[model samples]
Target: MSRRNVYLDLIPPRQAVQRACDALNRKELVQTETIPTHEAAGRTLATSVTARCSSPTFHSAAMDGVAVRAADTFAAREDAPLELQKGRDYDPVNTGNPLPEGRDAVIMIENVLQVDDSTIRIEAPAFPWNHVRRIGEDIVATELLLPQGRVLSAYDVGALLAAGIWEIQVLERLRMTFIPTGDEVLDFSQRPTPQPGQVIESNSQVFASLARSWNAIPSRTATIPDDAAALTQAVRDALASDAHIVVVGAGSSAGSRDYTKAVFEQVGTLLCHGINVMPGKPTLLAEAQGKLLVGAPGYPVSAVICFEDVLAPIAAYLSRRDAPQRRSLPVQLIRRTPSRLGQEEVVRLAVGEVRGRFLAAPLSRGAGMITTLTEAQAVTRIPTSVDGVEAGKTVTAELLVPEAELSRVLIHVGSHDNTLDLLADALMGLEVPLRLTSSHVGSMGGLTAVKNGTALFAGAHLFDPETRDFNFPFLRRYLPNLAVQVVNLAIRHQGLIVPRGNPKGIQGVSDLTRKDIRFINRQRGAGTRILLDHHLEVEGVDFEQVRGYEHEEFTHMAVAVNVLTGAADCGLGIRAAAEALDLDFVPLARERYDLIFPAEHAEDFRLQALLALIGTEAFKQRINNLGGYETTLTGQTMHPGQGLE
Candidate 1:
């Protein structure tokens, strides 16, 4: 049997961080260097900075006026004006000009009446030291300007220059070197197309970008294979360099091919091998040659959590700066999300302001799905003690985007459609862009979200076999009290997506009874599933006879991908999905897809803009260009009992 590395006792994220902190001696590991004060912005000070020279070394004029002694101008009054020669009683001065030797006050140019070239008259008495900047007024010589361990800002640079401090001693930026290790990883710099088992290497660049944001110097070595000796040498080399931290990407799990843990043990003391957090459990931490070594998981989301939560804090400690924190807000969850009991799961959310409160919908939890993070505006953590969070429950969420952006987010919880993507893109082209963040929970789930007041709007295409009507029938039954307005987005075709060549010879719904035909299905509440059941009944085919009927996908695109990848022979989905993946489609029915909005939110500016946008000829044209949609009712509002016509 090939030897595999076992994880150390799984500890909480905070405890693992504390162990790394206590093991490393910052004073010995990090050093200070002198650099120009102007170039020290964003750097932490190694020592306290004092002013060498006071601001305004000499008494100077604060305004453009005439410098004068207060005693000489005491006799001047508004009722009795007095005149004096410029050189004898006052000296002309502009802002910042040095005050004359005996002058104790400044008279405004507007207050003086110029009678001649060298003389002026004043009507008001000048007060002593009025509008005069005395020596050391802004800053005093030998006074503390900045304290040690303070992170410098651009304003701090200006203060340093004004206080006559030419140079500053700042803690050296923490240097980080990333080593990507895996035979299955390909360097993204080459732009190589990944084969089945190969994945493009991008975690290193992700870490590098994050490192820069933390004021750390980041470098990356070329990808190294999964050989134990090779990885050990790479870590040793990284340690030998000036790098304070070495991160080995991938090969950190308990798989037989994973060699990072073994390499960490060979060259250093393994402080932690796993963390009690989902998506980031395989994080490895070790100390070698008085430097930090990390083994990061290959999964994109897992790697981000490791970099942000684990490594970022340690880096902040070394750099003598406070770790960055995101703003948090309370949000209402739109759907029940389940999680395991042992680990804390980071659930990314599509958060937006609906009515006056924040509503959040959980995105995908796949550790390898990087798009989830990109699309999320906030994230909430599910506690280890809880099994899941129920719908309509309020939880505190850490914001991933600016708080102001929440209002501009248009939350749509509903069925998945390609036309919605077109609408999303068009909404962004408005003068004030609106972000359309959607959660595909099926049409029925959308109605539930609307009923709970968790979504700004929803997309649904529910069909009633008895009434031969769409969403109206379902709304009348499921939500009798809530008032809503429906608008037709488009009329779309639903069909069975097969391989490009239709290898399975699947012709119609009756073929589902054939043992050789494998089918993919949508989730229970999805409108597509209802359509499929209707067709199965009309064909007199038993649902139990269909192979892979229980296999469910959330979106039309997901269903198309199953067929594209040969996981299923065919799946019932929208025509756009089949066209997108270059698959063959067998048309089944044409359905009216509509947007459902709460009656109270009908006048909301975001909703109004959406309504106006879809009504435009250009937008209707775009829908027609999609090849599988009818634009006859593209942007018209619907009344009860209006079916297809």
Candidate 2:
């Protein structure tokens, strides 16, 4: 066994970017070329553009009327009308028409009365240069039309054409090549179904798309294996070509197989090894042949942060354009987000405008989960000095989506169910589409979020064995004073999810204690966990006797996955979850799953739309279609004493 290369002294991402920017000489690396003016939109100017010819080189008509010498119409008046001969006294012109020779003014057609084919009568006097576009009025010959380094827009194209600029000198679009590495990475172009321990390589495509958005040229080479010599050759080849930046995706960490640092050191000057950020800490920066070389982490989120925080700035500098910035807004945190003391953390948030204010719920923080980026409407940063942001505290968030879309987001801070997924899709089908963003933090967490006024609504299914009820008992115990409206989403069956064909022949809770039957459980404070405990008590099984009881998952689907993957023999979850993955289900108790909304937000349009959609028979039928769900009490208001009525 050989020791791997450790990271150099960690630096702030901004400082690393500045160091790269200071090292790369853009004038020597980035070339400029002449391109057609019409094809130069979104391209940066290499030098100031001067007009080749004056706009309206000759005096032209600015209005549709008659052109005549001012002295010819000076004596005309309302009381004494004057007659003029066509061509000699005046000439008819339309907008943008060139003025005839000797014409100094224009008599509007509305004021001129036609007497005959050769003559017309006029009552108003014409003034010099009236309704005329004078030469050099807009653009003067040899005048600066656009400044150097200006990013050309569509309007700039039209201006350039009018100024007689047929071609322009622009800085070349930055070229980047991404090389994906790893033996476990399957080529996405082949669309190969991934077996265990294999993953489809997609970070190259992500980087390519992001580079395109930055107006830079992006290409990818075939996947490279975890060979240091091969990676070094790839980097040298990219540098030998015209690529301004070279990126080696994955294998940048401290693992034995991670060879990016070694390859970078072999071919280039290592400017940075690690960043002082959470998801993007493994970022590497180096200069190879006066060009930027970036070693991005393997995780999707970390790669995105590396590209956005480090590569984007250097790219903008190379092309002489400002980096793109996202819109930002202050949003109240719906949950407590903890972070370490040293590294800055980026937290993705599901943000929505609720009750005339913006509310944000933190999504999953896993760097490998790209869905967090798709689901997040915004992202906030926890500074390196701070430990974390507390619930109900406001933080300024950089928006991933448009600000207007925030009002259409419906935030759910608790309990995961298959019905919620269906509801989310159904909401999007409405006349005014609404996006449902849910955070599965258990039933108790839902009540806590509602009490904190962080969520617009929450889903709950808390069961009370003493009262023989669900949700209401816990609501009274936890939230005694806050007024809320409870609406039943469905009465769902909860059961033990087992592998296909029930290889373990697990019957029910009685089988849970068997040494052969390793049971997976839900997290504490989860309604499903409570239900499992109640069943274990009834079956005379002690809590400590159940194997894998403490191996907890957060959602029903996750629990079912544990069973399906052979990690456990059986786990308790909703039948829908088992049915979803084609697993066997053992019948058990059924309970109500309800949506809780604060009474004050009863009139909110988003909440009202949800209520209206759920009340319809169509939504109920959809619920019934999911299998193992009873919609008899669906969309109806729930009371404390109402138990499965």
Candidate 3:
């Protein structure tokens, strides 16, 4: 082959994966080989597997007992145990043992103890399948076994061999070579005390592991010194070996001694260098005499990023390996983040429950920061042509983990509840990861979210001095025709949440009117804001006279956050949100925070789920444990107009 033919058509990871797949099409399996059914785990099926004989080939004992006809033990009971002649009326057999012909059921061995010579009695009647394995019970002949391209399991091998089948055809494994390069870097085994400007080498190990996990054989995983000559020799050795894909860890940069691109250019052909991506900007693609080559970064995080986002995808397609399904989710960005207009940026974030809102905190965006990935729950890709993304902007996140786990989460909008954390832990213990997205706008914010259909449900408590009613009035006023089922998640004391002790002589809503007091106010559209406005008009205090009234937050926890941070002198929220941050609460009035669901969505899965949560004795007990919460109306669906509005 000519030297020019040995060049990779360097492109984005998305394109590279596609290119490899196009180059290597799916091959049909026609050959079959004999393999021990037990050891053939994770091997793909070259051809369709079909059972030659029926499973449970004959009627067999399903339990360790005596085989007897159903009629024989029909009236057998404790007082009048029916006796039967051993071997004639009933034959004893162990579990999975073949039952003698004509037997319909088997009495448990415990029921038929050793009685007088060749005779036994059973106390209970046997039902079908209770103690018998019938013919073809497990499977039938000519049933499909493994489909083509399926990775074989140990159980599949057993089934194949049990069906009297021999070796089956499977796809060929991919051979990959990992080449680590850097002058200052040391091998994984070498505990080197490096001089200034030196760093420990770890990228090759990650590269190899990543490659092997994707069904690619790491035939040449090694850390090579950064000499163009040494790299040339290593590349020669790798190409000479059986490696189909050679990945160079680091050294793709255009800097001096960045010999990956240069070496590949000399040995084969350099298709392209650099993709418009953060951290992985210096990515390189090459082909050496028909073998694909990938050049990744030296940083451990960047190296792994490049592997999965770039090479492994191609390797999977090329090897005919099934590509794992990637799911995208619609998540609202917590705050504005900047990105280059023409360069795509992959940002990592730590998703967490703050109050009842799902708040995603941006992780360290440094290219070399491994902690960015360690702390991140997911990665969001910002496309080129968009310079920046605003806070609260909805963007699609490509999930590395399963999306079902995220969907099962309970999105709560309210003031922060530490109790929600407890609930989160309980749910997680049950293998259900409950995402408690707390947007702490306080009790009022939660109701507004329910009214707007912007959230699943909200946690709220608002004290109305006039009507002396709870959420019913607000629901009636704002969300008309909203089929609202008010399930009381909590009922906490409403009041002025102050610092440790009231340093200032502050009491009730009147103290917030003081000129020196810088008050933190909940944002407009929040139920808390409505209640605050109601109090302001009744108290005859001008909001313009108050400082920090225009300052806004989306949740109670956020208000507490600002107050705790000294950003505001005081704020009005639930006692829980206040106490959580060690602030003091002056009891104003008790209020109910109920979860409201739309009438049309009354039987929706989310509402059904909320009903189950409220109905549980454990949840009821928890609501009671939270000091002021009244569980009388808890789980009760207060019909529309029964509560507010």
Candidate 4:
């Protein structure tokens, strides 16, 4: 609970994590075999699995339709409809049906009208290869169904059976056993829950689940008494069993009750302990008689971290398998965060949409707090060398979700606009997953992203007095050749976000020039920034003459946080951010916020999601709730030459 702690020497994030991994003996273990293809769903492949035969060996129909030779229907015209009788002219077939000999095209049942006596009339000429599924269209016979070391998917199972491969070579699953050793630890099974200091042992569950997710079987998770004798007995039992990997939970630290190191050294060679990572530093790795033992920390995130840091790799080595879990990305920080100099910090984050952009909000982290990880989408690492990442600084993060998610996300990197969430949520059940990653820079920043091709689209509200418009002039000047369809996200009022009840006694953008005022500004090139700058120029106010002009954050929430914490007097953002934080809003300018994307990206599957949201009444309802927003341009597309500013 002490906010005051002495500074500790730090180390690079990568080196600390790597040293922890390097200590384990992973290069020598390999246990593998072959199994039935049907049972390979959760198993990793030990060797390449080539297809025994091609899928869809013959030409077949992809849909239920009448198949006819292209040459037979080539001369058919709409006015003079061609009549075909089944059993003579063509064969009626259903989906997945093999194409009959001499047939090269298909006319959908709906495309042809049925007449009297088994005859059908075609209104148009069907193309030569229309609706025809060619031989080996899906896959070629004797081809690779799965490559060596490939983890099998659901589709892979179906393909394996289709290819006539009954069995497949898979890495033998790594069998792990977890032994929880801590005097304070209590099992979670059938519990009313432990009161305060009494621990509910659940790190084993995390390890077991993660192990299962990686195609490894967790054999037994036993809660051993805290004493060294009891711990030693448990370790012997695990070694006696068929387990290939052993995880000793909780007791790896140098504390008296923590006998994992002692027990490991008594029976096996201790590899290393105390990795340079926060929360899960007391990790132990050992090897004994061809078996690997990993002693993970008791803290939930720490347990999960050690599971990923230590156990995952050992399991991979034992099975001769590598499971690709979720993916990762490098993103700019929304706020400043510090870390210990000698240890790596794995900070969890809840990624959210802000101003047509994606921003990661750091979560409350403690080794004992599992809820933080539960709310997190990814883990951002801070190196030991620095206390934390400064606001607007970029850092790498490993996603706990899927990488395909990145494709589903329409990354917006500017201006706080609420319409984006509306646009995204409207894409529910869409063919492609739709998400919005909005980074709240100002309108100008968004335009720059569009210009730099760093964003799919930005929500911009830049205004031009000369042309009496919003966005078009800037887009034309900055993003020339960027053929974009500017669809209005919303028409919102530009304003100053202040603490509740207007404690700052500030009104209008001119107050920003006040010497006593400390301000949080939107990032440079952001739409909000452009709006602020334009207002300043029109009012003849020099931004450099203002106080705290250099202070900036990536999202409205971060900006609001600055105001709430007294770091700044106010910031330029949407009214929603102010209202959400129970803050005050001072209207300055009204501008149209539209999505700006590369013209070529107009058809990106992800943007369809934004369009869906814009078109929905429900999305409109949400936007209506956010004060100072107008939804008229919600779904309408504005082309390059259009004059709407």
- Across 1-645, the per-residue lDDT of candidate 2 in tens digits comes to 546768767889889989999998999999999999999999999999999999989899988888999998899999999899998898999988999999988877888899989899998888999999999998999999999999999999999999999999999999999999999999999999999999999999999999999999999998999887888888899989989999999988888999999888888899999998989999999998999999999999999999998899889888888988999989998778999998999999999877788999888899999999999999999999999999889999999998989999999978889999999999999999999999898888889888878788889998898888889898899899999999999999999999999988888898877888798989887888889899999999998899999899999999989988899888999999999999999998999999999999988999999999999999999998889999999999998888774
Candidate 4 Cα lDDT to native: 0.73
Please report the candidate that would top lDDT against the real structure: 1
Each model's lDDT = 0.92, 0.91, 0.68, 0.73
Ranking by lDDT: 1, 2, 4, 3
Q: Taking the tens digit of each residue's C-alpha lDDT, what string does model 3 give over 467-583? A: 677767666666666776666665556567677776776686777878778898877766567667777787888888778889987667778888777777788776777877788
The clash number for model 2 is 0
TM-score (C-alpha) between model 1 and the true structure: 0.97
- Local error of candidate 1 at residue 303 (angstroms): 1.0
True-vs-predicted CA distance for residue 462, candidate 2, Å: 2.0
lDDT of 4 by residue, 1-645 (tens): 212211132233234344434554444444577788888886777777777777678888877889998778867788989988887888888888989988888889888888976898897888877898887787787776678767688888998888888988776777789887776788788583776567887887887788887777785555788777888888988888888778898877766567787778888876667677887787777777667777788878888877886566556555556634556777666656778775778898756433445556566677888978865667887877787777667777788766555455556666766556555566645666565555565677677666765566777777777777778888878777777777877777668998888876889888888888888887777667667778888889998977877887767777888998778889888787787788889988777777776767756666665676577777776888977787776767765444443
Worst 10 residues of 4 by lDDT: 1-10
lDDT of 2: 0.91
The runs of at least 3 residues in candidate 2 whose Cα sits more than 4 Å from the true structure, single-residue gaps closed, are 71-89, 107-126
Better of 1 and 4 by lDDT: 1
